[model samples]
Target: MQPIVHPVVGYVCYAVYARWADGTPPASSPAAVAVVAATLPDLLDQPLYHAGITPVGRTIGHSLLFAVPLVALVWLVARRRGQSRLAVAFAIGYGSHIAADVPWHVLAGDYHELGFLLWPVTPMPAYSGVKTLGTVGGLEVTTLWLEAVIFVGGVALWWADGRPGLDLLGRRFDL
Candidate 1:
């Protein structure tokens, strides 16, 4: 999945969870956390891989080895601070990111890409070359279209939910 899609998925997931849990729209702080957490895996792994610090772009950061423990720690800390909702939001974002990366290859019976989930227990596949954007034309045209659709839908939903985090940014930037 592309980086842009991750945060949209995170926001949508958190919005759904918030409504289901409390019949309320997501608050700014948690919404922001969700967006950042959604990009955490890539933020950690991509730089490391590009630096040649890791063999693949999806190694330790993408592994359950990292996510499970980190999320548990966040939950523990947040619960103590009476901010468990934030932890839940983070988990929703992070977990959705990992899940999003899996389905496409799995549905195609390409299990080799899944080695990232195990990290040291299993070797991740080498970096695949980048895919061209839909406008430019490539094998990933369908993926780009799907991402675009999801982004548009997510934006509409966010707007319908009163644009939870926008006010926070506006206040900070005086926009």
Candidate 2:
């Protein structure tokens, strides 16, 4: 899961939250900040890759520990800025990233060496295997399949969200 995937997952998670939870903000709520905050940890990893402190896609950005605290920090900052609503949105989106990515990786058994998520305490290994849906001749067809699934899910989310009274918070937002 890269940064791009986080928002979609986060939105879907938010949708589910909105459907089940009374306090969930709708699409019109100030969710952009929270959504971005949820993805901020990964964005921070971009600089680390340039400095060689960590590999481009192998760092805390993909870890639960990092994502939770970062989102909390965002929430705190947003509170200070009088944008707590946005902070919550970011938290949902960011948390959604973890919820979606972690389990799948766990199930696939594809974690990498440097990708020790639990770190000093747990040092849990991540799944590093590529999940291919199928193979066409010599080429793997998993990528296309994954993309299609994501696209369909995204479309469904958009539709579900567009329904009346579907937005989590009633107010508008900016990310």
Candidate 3:
């Protein structure tokens, strides 16, 4: 999935999960945090691909090996802070991003790409050259259309939310 789509779905999942778990209408602050978490995998992996630090576009960053522990740490802190709902919301965002990518991975014929899901236990397919978004492996038109649909769906959902403003990068404002 594309960067924008990844975070959009993450925000929606965070909102729904928050409502389910906490019986709240998606607390603005936590939902804001979830959006960044949703994009963390690509955020961490891509620079490494460009810098020649890793061969694969997906690395430990995309693996449960990395996310689980980080989430566990966040979970612990959240429990202590009495904000378990927020922590779980972040997990929903992170996990949903990975789930959204699965279809594209399959369409690209990179079924073996699950090696990245295993991280150190299995070697990631490290290809040379910086990876771009939309289609994985090659120009798979189906995957491209799937991405388009997902992104458009996200836009529609955002509009439905009355365009709840996100002040994610500055002032730390959630609403």
Candidate 4:
């Protein structure tokens, strides 16, 4: 899967979370948290990996080591503070990122890579620091099936996000 696909997955998960849990659209503060949490792993992982701080993009940041405890902590705090919905919304997006990434490598028979999902408790292999984001630029040519899924999910997200969250520009970035 590509990087763009991750966030699209996040958005789709946001919609799913709303429909299944909240009955409200994934919007307002929760939507804001979801969007950021979705992309956070890559945002923190890449530059660190690129700079040789870690051997792989899947580090503590991408691991259950980080996510489980963080989400638990957030859930606990949110419940105490009466913000459980926000915590659940963020967890949906954050967890969906890892869920989506796991299959992308697993289907290719990279079993050892699975440890990255639970890291520290499981060992990690070196990830050659190479940029993969460029792969997304050739969307139509390289990843026809994946791109199609992204397109459909994007359309769904547009509808589910209440269809002009795009007015963010005119609304002066309400998100």
Residues 30-103 of candidate 4 have per-residue lDDT tens digits of 76667667888888888988999887777877898899998888889988999987788789878888887775
Tens-digit lDDT string for candidate 1 (78-109): 99999988999999989988988886566545
Q: Highest lDDT among the candidates is held by which one?
A: 1
The lDDT of each candidate is 0.85, 0.59, 0.73, 0.71
lDDT score for candidate 3 against the true structure? 0.73
Q: Is candidate 1 or candidate 2 better by lDDT?
A: 1
Q: What is the overall TM-score of model 3 with all chains considered together?
A: 0.79
Write candidate 3's Cα lDDT for 1-175 as tens digits. 6666888888778767766776755666677667778898899988998899888778877888998898889889988999876788778878887777666656555667667787878887643222233555777445456667877886676666655435444455533
Task: Return the candidate ranking by TM-score, descending.
Answer: 1, 3, 4, 2
Can you tell me which runs of candidate 1 are displaced by over 4 Å?
127-141
Q: Model 1, residue 173: displacement in angstroms?
A: 3.5
- Candidate 3 Cα errors over 4 Å, as ranges: 19-25, 126-141, 165-175
Scored against the true structure, residue 164 in model 3 reaches a CA lDDT of 46
Candidate 3: pairs in clash: 55-126, 56-126
